[model samples]
Target: MTATIPAQTGGDLPAHNITISEFGAMKALAILSQSGKENAGVRVFIKSGGCSGYQYGMAIDDRELDGDTIVHDRGVKLLVDRMSLPLLRGSEVDFVENMMGGGFTVHNPNATSSCGCGHSFRTDGAQSPDGEGSGGCGSH
Candidate 1:
C-alpha cells in the first residue's frame, strides 16, 4: 500500500481533488450541530467486512491530530486522518433521513466493489482495518 499524506496548501481552505456535494454538506452540518460540542469532527475509516471487502467506520471525536485534512462545509468542520484522507478524497458523506431509515452514507468513487448494504467496499490491495479485512461478516 502506498502511504500518502493528503496534499495541502497555505490557502484558507485545504486543497482537495475530492468532490463533496452541497446536499451532503448540509446534512453533515446538521449532524455536527446536533452532536455535543468538544467533538473534534467525524472520523471515517475503513474496516474489512461485508460482502464486498471493506466497510466504513465513522465516529465523533473531539481530539484531532496535527496535519489532518480539515474541511469546512455548510456549518460543520470535518477532519480526515492523514492516512485515510487520500482514500476518502472526493468522497461525499451525507445523512439520510426518512420515515423508515436514517443514517450516514458515503459515495466513494474509490470503491471498486461495495456490499448491498453499502457499508463496505474494497480497493486495489488495501487491507480492511475492521480487523482481518473480512469484518467477520462471512458468517453473518
Candidate 2:
C-alpha cells in the first residue's frame, strides 16, 4: 500500500508520521530496483550505541516483523519497528550527495544533538551520564 503525505517545511512535519522527500524517494527506488529488491522495504531503526546515546540504522528488508509500522511515500516503503518508533516519530528520510559521497540520512526532530557524521544522535530524554555520548562514529 502507498500513502501520500502533504508537503511540510522545516519544523512543520506531521506530528505522528514519518515523511520522505521527493529526491529521497526517487533515489531509494532506484537503489532498490538496481539491487533486485523492488518488492522490499527500507527498515529504519534506532539502536543503543553511537557517538550519541542512540544510532540510526536502515536496511533493505523483505519481511515485516510484528509491531512494525510500514510507511509508503512516493513509491518507496519504510519500515520502523515498534521499539524504535517513539524516537523516530516525525523524522524525515532523505538522501544527500556531496563531494565526499552519498547516503541516506534521517532528519529527526527528537534529536537534541547529532554526531559529526550524522549517523548518531541523542534525544532530550536519552541523554548520557556526561550529558554527551562517547565514541567515534568510525568505531561503529
Candidate 3:
C-alpha cells in the first residue's frame, strides 16, 4: 500500500510530503516487532556531511519533538523534523533487495545529485562545504 502524507500549506514553509511503499511498511513493522519497539515510529532526517553534502538518517523513536511531522502510511508512522522536511519533500521510502542485501532507500525528488551508494545527496542550490567528490560506494 502506497500512501502520501499531505503537505502543510500556507506560511513560508515549502510544500513537503513523503510516501511509503508496501514493502517498506512490512519491513519496518517486522523490525519494530523484533526490536520490541512496536509503539515506536521511524524517524527520518537529513544531516550535514557525506560526499554529497547531506546524508539521510533513520531510527526507531517513540518520542515526538516540538517540530516533528508524524505521518502514518500502511500501518507505519514516519517522524520527519521541520529542518529535514523541505529537503525530503516529494520523497518515497521503499525497501529494495539485491544480491548484496536488502534495505530501505529514499527516492528524493529534491535531490539533483546523489552519491553512488544513495546515502548522500545534493540539492540544486546546495553544495557540500568540503567540496568532496563521489569517489566510490561505501557500506552504510
The candidate that wins on lDDT is 2
1 or 2: which has the higher TM-score?
2
Show where candidate 3 strays beyond 4 Å. Answer: 1-14, 130-136
List runs of model 2 lying over 4 Å from the truth. 1-14, 129-133
Q: How well is each residue in 1-140 modelled by candidate 3, as lDDT tens digits? A: 22335433233433466767789989998887777764798889998767787889989897788878877777888889988988888787888998989888898989998888788888975667566533454623
Of 1 and 3, the candidate ranking higher by lDDT: 3
Global lDDT for candidate 2? 0.80
Sorted on lDDT, highest at the top, how do the candidates line up? 2, 3, 1
lDDT values, one for every candidate: 0.61, 0.80, 0.77
Query: What are the per-model numbers of colliding residue pairs?
Result: 9, 0, 0
Tens-place lDDT per residue, model 2, 42-93, is 8889888788778889888888787787777777878888888898888989
TM-score of 2: 0.83
Per-residue lDDT for 1-140 in model 1, tens only? 22223322233433343334567667666666688866556666655466566667777766666766666554455667666776676677777776968787788878877666677777765655455445444532
- Backbone clash tally (model 3): 0
Superposed Cα RMSD, model 3: 5.8
